[model samples]
Target: MTDQPTPRAQRFAGRRVIVTGAAGGLGQVVAELFRAEGAAVVATDVAPAEDVVACDLSDDAAREGFVADALAELGGLDVLCNVAGIQQFAAIGAITADALRRHFDVNALAPLMLAQACAEALVESKGNVVSVASISSVMGQPYNAPYCASKAALLLGMRALGVELATRGVRVNCVSPGGIATPMVEAAAAGLPADTNWDLIARSTSVIPGFMPPADVAEALLYLASDAAASVTGANLVVDRGVVW
Candidate 1:
């Protein structure tokens, strides 16, 4: 099914939120859902969109600027949803330093940097951070060293933040999805090497078979960001159809 916001109530009424990568795919769905739930969202993405501010998340200056814009537009921060990421697959022999850096910069470092930029605001508002990790983070995925490594880093970083920010009244968590039916995933799967091992892939494949809809994964993210998860912190809620087991 296509991504659609089915907000049942104003769970985030009067909340000020920062949503990265809001231009398309799961990010777009997350932003739409937050707004539908009465959140004043400050959305940004590297890809230019009408309402999404252009911010190259890998750059420190741009991150600071985006945080500034968020604070200015929505006042104080109530939640930070780090939905921006890059997932490029490369076989072990093909993995390079540049590839590793590119993946970590966007997938892992960007989320951590954004959290640091909004730390005080989050603490002040007693808010939380919910990031989108990947099933590769908790499982070994072939031809995806960089993506997997970076996602693992993202998961650890969120856990570290969850502990560091807990006493400050700020929470941090992640939703590690096995796979989502997005253009990014489709392209990566299409570009896999011809000599790829199908049997090895099947070892960790989701029991549900195909990738999940973006909306389904987005729901997990929103749940972690909501007050319904008040006592939850440093948790990596896996929504990967039992892939990690």
Candidate 2:
């Protein structure tokens, strides 16, 4: 008898996926994980990678073009991971209109637009979406008014989308992370006070021994995008090492 072909890993094995902000940090890791797990990952960012498409998230034309090209290049899309975001340290009194708009454009509005464009394809594939919110959605943090507010809005948006798309078999979920060690964090750390108590903050937020690496956040996203999470939807998986609880 002829040998049979190997069984596929899951629905992801042949599916096309779109990951925004895919050039760096958590976005890069998340895109890589999906690719490793057998998805045809269309990694996208304003600054493209050799294997990714570069498109500006804030530009309406660029966002539309990305959706169109993603469909054309990948044949169709199965998952959308909205991992592009920006953060600013501004107290409520110090929050400028430009600063807040920039944060919202990247952190909240971009994801919503991407989702709107991909919803029809996702419904066709019965695929899911995973967004990257932050722990600040649930807890208060000083000197980050706009970032926190934008993340909170992202969480709510995920919930609403999950409900609206339920009957169509499209699931929407998000992951909230605390104190992830990315280049952005390194830059912020360089500006900290001489006596900043880093350990205290880590211990307070993370139930895990070390501060979370980007991979930790990426894996959480992979789970939400996988068939293992088939019954899961409208959930915000908080990977803060137990910070909010």
Candidate 3:
């Protein structure tokens, strides 16, 4: 087979990327994938680690500082992947204002703020952004009102920004994943009532029969952030295995 044409090189070669929530789970996977694809990656998380820049995204000063540090370290930024989020499950009457605000702060506001901080750099580099939303953003899930609302807001905000930034050559998109088999999902499931019908809730809407993996979502992000998707701004790529349907 003529050596299969020697396969092309990694897609993100020479690109500078910033990935938030890189300490674990989906964020960590996305960051590693970018690095594997030959991108210079600045990985940030709330907890400090030898391989991560610590920044609590809820704090405005810290968030801004993290962006500055990421840019300084990377020299330039071509892609930003906002994958940090919080999820909690509680009955409507049990949901506290603090919990609701926490979801919005981390899931919705932080992504928007990061996008704002990186806007100029993205414009200059003709870069792109990919945010991780949730399938619940489109289809409501019981006992997850706050989480769903926050993700919905994030999804719409990214779409609007995609429009506003198109002329500036900065593309923005979102990836909505459904029931990814991660520690985060396991923890969320553990918090649910013992009587909860997880079977019903986890049912797939597509032909696929199981939970998606973090890497599936990461690949969707890669496509949106890569030059391969040059004309695909203002879109939400649903990696839910057709769960919304």
Candidate achieving the largest lDDT: 1
> lDDT per residue, candidate 3, 90-196, as tens digits?
77777899999999999999999999999999999999999999887888787788999999999999999999999999999998898788877778765566667
Ranking by TM-score: 1, 3, 2
Q: Write the per-residue lDDT of candidate 2 for residues 1-245, one digit (tens) a residue.
A: 99986553454688799998888889888887787778888888888587878888889998998899889988988899999888756445666899888888888999998999999999998998999998988776766678888999989988999999999999999999888878766665443444545564443456665668899899889889888999999999988877787
Which scores greater on TM-score, model 1 or model 2? 1
Best by TM-score: 1
**Inter-residue clash pairs, candidate 2:** 207-241
Residue lDDT tens for model 1, 181-202: 8888887776577898888878
Q: How much lDDT does each candidate structure score? A: 0.90, 0.84, 0.88
TM-score of each: 0.95, 0.88, 0.92
The superposed Cα distance between candidate 1 and the true structure at residue 209, in angstroms, equals 2.5
Off by over 4 Å in 3: 1-8, 194-207
Predicted structure 1: lDDT:
0.90
Q: Of 1 and 3, which scores higher on lDDT? A: 1
Which scores better on TM-score, 2 or 3?
A: 3
